[model samples]
Target: MPTYEMGQWLLVMCHRTQQPSPDYLVAAFPTDEIREAYLSIASERAEQEVRHILRAFVGHSRSLGSFDRLQVLSIEALRKEQGREATKNGWSPRFTEYEIRALNHLSGTSSTPTWEGLTWALDLLPHAPQKAIDVIHAYMYAHAQVLPDLRISGLTDAAELIRTRYILQGSASIETLLELILNLDSRDFEYLVAHLYEVLGYDTEVTPAQKDYGKDVIARKINETVFIECKNWQGHVGVKVISDLAGRVSMEQATRGIVIGTSGFTEGPATATEIASRWPSRISLLDGIELIKLMNQHLGSEWHRRVERIIQSERSRQDRRPK
Candidate 1:
């Protein structure tokens, strides 16, 4: 794939019409060119993708300017709201700079259709548009690591820094890994594997292998079985990772297997395929992104609050330390 300038990103769309899409969409291209061009495009979405370095500054940041549906307070108002003084309503806020950052990350960026919209539409309609979702997730994964303008003096906590990126962008992938382990329901494995199948719009449940099988969860859909092994891996999951999950799938006599982990796949696709080929059924793959999609498909961003609560709880535990 070809890279564009700082202001543009490629939103890949397939069409059955006249021509193939070029490398990217950019405002630099001429209007006459657009009229003659065969591919659909949006330079605006591309520009919005990278405009925010800090997750907290996406749309509502006074610095970057305004976005739709959200009205930001003036600097004087914010200053007072930050507890510098009291508002006209006789209210003084306890909003720290960090919390301000957190607030912005929760809001959506420009030209992006957030899950908030999807949820609304799902309330009105039954199913989400398949293509729109794919496009949304692709854009999400593309810009997933973007940071908001935290505007801090220096970088000290790298984990927090990366976590902040996902926090603002509403990325399920990073939320799945690299931040916090959430929903340790003990039943989470059953739900996660079940939900993975659910995301694919299928019926699923645990099988006998789930009871005596090395696999913790078994999914059934349309006469197919997808056995799953989940681990809350904090770091990279390697060949041994694939092998262990693969073993569990074999014992269960499953048609397929999936190994879910919070970390990244240590081996490349070819190696993964090679390992999967050694087994009876092909083992499918899912890293952090897939896991997040499963969450969004079933749990939504609401799940993050539980993860955040865990963080807060851990922080509280640490805070009880003696000086």
Candidate 2:
């Protein structure tokens, strides 16, 4: 038998007899090491996805403000079930039928799935050497977290008990995309700011630092300034947020103020125009996904590592937990 095939046999034994690595035959699952490995892989996968999604979705190299509308579509095909594919405007180039089937555990129909196959592909952490069963088990474990318990407990339509979650539409919330732009997280934020900053050549500092301000963020270089207020809240951000931030802008020795959030401006463009007429060039807006692109552009690979590390750490911790 091939080495990997041999490993599967060993894994099966280990799972049945519930033994550790050396002792293959066991009745219980090796939840600890498996979880750890799964998390490690997941963390790296999240970074890759973030980068891929940003580069692909934030296409045209245009400033986020330029886009008329943004939507995320699934990369997995109609047959793949609930696989949410794109984030912003990103898409996966391809996937096999079997892969798609395995990825659609939560999805009963092949018409449209919710999660993504890529997430399943990344389930195995130290998967350098493994077998189909091993991969399937890991897939089951991951899927079990979201799907009904019967999935892993072995009580569902076995064929439909596939092993993945896919995103159907990956669009960022209209409001939150803005928050990303005003505040600096990485390349995406930096990229947007670089362009905006260059547009007016405005430079001025915010009096209360982001940490001290207890809200929003600001940056400057010359006499001009740009104020940023980031909000991760759901629903539309009302005039209150903008008005309060405006108050802060007055306090800051800056030129312009921008409000950002996943929810975005509560007021429509017309209202925004009216407000802008009242306080022209005083404040602007950006939401979630937009924020990500700007940060990716500005910060680039630097923040990529940070994102990856955060995801990886979270996964690692999840893995270490007892089943």
Candidate 3:
């Protein structure tokens, strides 16, 4: 006999004719095999046979009425929905399956996983190290407040090392840097903006992916607060985007608002001038060209071979450790 996990399969009935009525749960099974076995014979008898069997199982206790469709959701889909709900509630950071596996491998003995341990574990994985790094960066960006103390310190040190490496060896020119920035997905682009603010001496927080209230990042320095909206669009951002940011700025009482558009703003300089005149000091726009310039100014253009030195040093340090 094979054992099955509880709540692994959900039998949902869709009643399309019932206006404003949500999908009703007809039954919950421990496995898809069990659910399929229950419906297969009935389905083979007749199209309406499955419905009759489900109705008999329902025992007239519940009023699902007539359902036109039936859907069986697997455990993976249910877990994804639960994860989304958790993220929306800001209760936990969502991690992909690979990330969770890596973290679990690192936390074999202890309840908490440290950044250094995670890095070591990731080095042993077949996947590229950058994927795990992005996962860590995203987790740190969104859940900075609730991270363990040791993990926080370790992640801070690792982030500093990576940031220094990027500043030194990431790109040689503004054009190359802009190309790399453009290749990042929307979520990573938001993280890039948040990282830039942190580098610029402002404490930053990235809002949860869902329901961010039109702001992607919030930055604060001393008495000033800034709300940033990132648009990783291939086309130019329009006035409506700027208008929405302006509203959020006022609502959040932010000191200023900045929109970073990867493909620049519509109508070129005219749009920038119009926004400046309308919002004055309240809003600022940074197109791709200006964003590159700002990065060059702050991140510098000089290239040093420090990244190689750091790698060599790390290798030597690791080699000295007991095997």
- On lDDT, the leading prediction is 3
Tell me model 1's lDDT, rounded to 2 decimals: 0.43
Residue by residue across 1-323, what tens digits does model 3's lDDT show? 33443232222222322222222223323235655454333212332433322332322322111110111122235557878988788666455533443344443643432222233323311122233345557756754643444445445443332333233223355566666667766766776566557657887777768978888988899989999999988788888889889988998788999989988877655574476558879999888777655543344322122323333443344345453
TM-score winner between 1 and 3, please give it: 3
Alpha-carbon shift of residue 144 in model 2 (angstroms) = 59
Candidate 1 lDDT over 1-323, as tens digits, reads 54433222223221112112442323222123332231222211232332221122111223332331132344335655555445456666765343344345444434322212112221211122233334334433543433222311111121122222222233334654445443455344444455445556665544343463456555667667776766666666567767867776666566777877666566656565466556645676677666765554444433555554433443343345353
Listed per candidate, the RMSD to the true structure in angstroms reads 19.3, 20.3, 26.2
Q: Is candidate 1 or candidate 2 better by lDDT?
A: 1
User: Which TM-score value belongs to model 1?
Assistant: 0.38
Ranking of candidates on lDDT, top first: 3, 1, 2
> Candidate 2 regions off by >4 Å?
1-215, 251-253, 269-277, 301-305, 308-323
Candidate 1, which ten residues in sequence have the lowest lDDT sum? 151-160
- Segments of candidate 3 deviating more than 4 angstroms: 1-171, 268-273, 302-323
